[model samples]
Target: VKVFGEFEFWFALIKVVAIVAMIALGSSVIFFGFTNDWNPIGFSNLWQHGGFFPNGIGGMLLSLQMVLFAYVGIEMIGLSAGEAENPRKTIPMAIDSLAWRILIFYMGAILVILAIFPWNEVGQQGSPFVVMFERIGLREAAGIINFVVITAALSSCNAGIFSGGRLLYALSVNGYAPSPFAKLSKYGVPNRAVMATVAVCMTGVVLNYFVPDKAFQYVMAAVTFVGLMVWIAILLTQIQFRRSLTQSQVAELAYRTPWWPYSSWFALAFITLVVVLMGFHEDARIALVLGPCLLGVYLAMFYIVGLHRKTKLSREFK
Candidate 1:
């Protein structure tokens, strides 16, 4: 896991560098026409295709799920907080700077891509970044872009492994999962929990191997639903935590979420909107139904198996 963590760090750095390079190269193409025989490309493509809102406000609103999906990495900050050496300082800084980073990296890259190529035709062949680099007479760079993309994918997998192991370990400690998951190796690693997480993830790989086509879509739909639920839970937990604090305690806190309760409420509303919008998309609609049903089953099991009783017993003993 430690070795994987190192690789993950470098993979993330590569992704950041690749995005910055793409944005820089794309900007040159947009303004200076670095690759288009010195003829500037400009931002005409954004409006020329369908005047900014090709499919209208509804279309834009419907895309919130995909946008939210891209922001899933933000949740990793909270997941990693338990292991953070100075969470009070680091977590707050990470949370505060996330918006600016997203604007500069995600929004900036999208702006560059749209400016350099027509939106509709951008992903028709492959990545817009790949096409842009190829157009810039850097075929070698385009090939490297593919390698960078693969690393980015692997980085996501690395995150899944890290987060899943930690989460299972936490659950086990809380008496919600098998006790074996709470065990730690000599290196303080949850080897059992990590192996279990990998086994669960491997099922998906096997499914992909067999189905080849529908597996990814199905997995994504489930992931989106699970991600939405996780975000909603986090916001709810934060609201409850704030409510549990007295005014003096709140005032003494080193970190606070800006706008307090209102921002959290808005987040809940936005998540609710995304959940509703999911029903409109055929591919994602199953999640809307299945997600709640699964949650219901889990809730039922909590009582049926007397896990709640175990929790109360543990608290009393403590």
Candidate 2:
């Protein structure tokens, strides 16, 4: 945690600074003609081209598959609570700030980019931020954007390694994974689990090298499908946990999701809708097939490894 925590801090800071800078720069260009010629860029670019929603409602719904993919590892925030010194205080604060972060980092950035440049002109080949900066005659700023993008990728890898090792360790301790994965290093690190995760990541890299064209699409779809299932499982678990608690016990909770059943049901329905939409997409449709097959494989592993017997024994003990 210590090694990666430092890198995560710097990477997150750079991303935040970059987003804020872009927003401010875009605002200046829109409101005060801060570009090269000192001529107001105006907001006509936002609507004059395709008048927004050019792809229609179905297109927007289909895009949610990728949008959900962007949030794939966000649940790690909750998972990390188990290791926190003060989880009750830190977890709730992190959860509450999530919406604001999404609004500012994702929505704000997209809004500014679209407002500054015509939607159609934003190419698919490179980062829109780089394009925006270069268009404004700041080539050096574009180079910096590229560097930031690299750091972002590195940050993602760092997070993946951290979360993957912890999850593997949890599984090992629960008797689902191999006992070797439960072992820790002198520094209290799950070295075996971490090595396993790195091995899996390398397999992915080799697979990508073999089929570079289709690799990302396939991986994104699979990851998004798994992420959605994880979220559903979490909500259901929370609901069951709440049902097991008395009203007074619930009242004493450190954090509670607002609207209870209503919000939970709404989120479930929305995620289901996204999954259904994935079937309509060519690349994402594979996930609908792969997901069930993967689940079946896990079920087989559970029984094959005698986990069902262990579960029965635990229940008898309880």
Candidate 3:
């Protein structure tokens, strides 16, 4: 697992460097008048046709749910906290980097893409990355994008499985899951936990075989809300943790979530708004329905198996 983690770290670094390079190149093409054969493709399409908020506030509101899912793997940092040598410092750095990541990697790329191509034509032109490359006379644009997309997907999937397996192992150790899930492989990996996670992911693979066109959409519609719920729980837990600490202890801490309770409250309100927005959108309704039902099952099991009592007693004795 250590070796695997090292490999993932390198792979992820390469991924980020590549995307940043692309964004820089694209921004240069858009602003400088050097890339597109000295024809600066300034930001006209942004508001030329129908103004900036072309689709209006409704479209922006609808996209909020999509943005929540976009930040899915951010929580993987929490999973790695147990192994981090300087988690207090490193985690805050990581969290702060997310703002820049969203700004540079996502928004910067988006602005570059929209500057070069109209919003409506983006989908019809295939990937905007490939389009930007093609505009610069890159003959291998399609192949390059294909390779990058594959690597990106593999990296994201690897991170997800690795983090989730660790979480399952933790749950098992804490008596929330089957004891067998706590076992580790010779490589010091949570083999059973990883296998179980892979099995769950394989359900999507199976769905792809049967319903290729709609598999991703259906799965996303059902599970994205769960990701938001996880995010909200983490935020709430952070607030509670801050409350548990003395003001002196908090001031002594090197790293902390910014704005403390206000940040958590704002995030909770934003997430709740997204969930409510999900109710208004047709495709998003699936998540709203399934998300609550899933939570209900967890709550029911907590009561049925006396996990709350078990956990309370464990904490008391500890």
Over the stretch 201-294, how does candidate 3's per-residue lDDT look in tens digits?
Answer: 8888998999898787667766678888887888888888889999899989878667767878998998888888988877788778878988
lDDT of each: 0.85, 0.87, 0.79
User: What order do candidates take by lDDT, descending?
Assistant: 2, 1, 3
**Global lDDT for candidate 1?**
0.85
Clashes of each: 0, 0, 0
Q: Assess candidate 3 and give its lDDT.
A: 0.79
Off by over 4 Å in 2: 309-318
How do these models rank on TM-score, best leading? 2, 1, 3
Stretches off by above 4 angstroms in model 3 are: 312-318
What TM-scores do the predictions have?
Answer: 0.94, 0.94, 0.92
Residues 212-302 of candidate 1: C-alpha lDDT, one tens digit per residue: 8878766777788889999999999999999999999999887888898899999999898898999897778888888999999999998
Error of 2 at 227 (Å): 0.8
Summing lDDT over every window of 10 consecutive residues in candidate 3, give the lowest-scoring window. 309-318
TM-score comparison, 1 vs 3, better candidate: 1
Pairs that clash in candidate 3: none
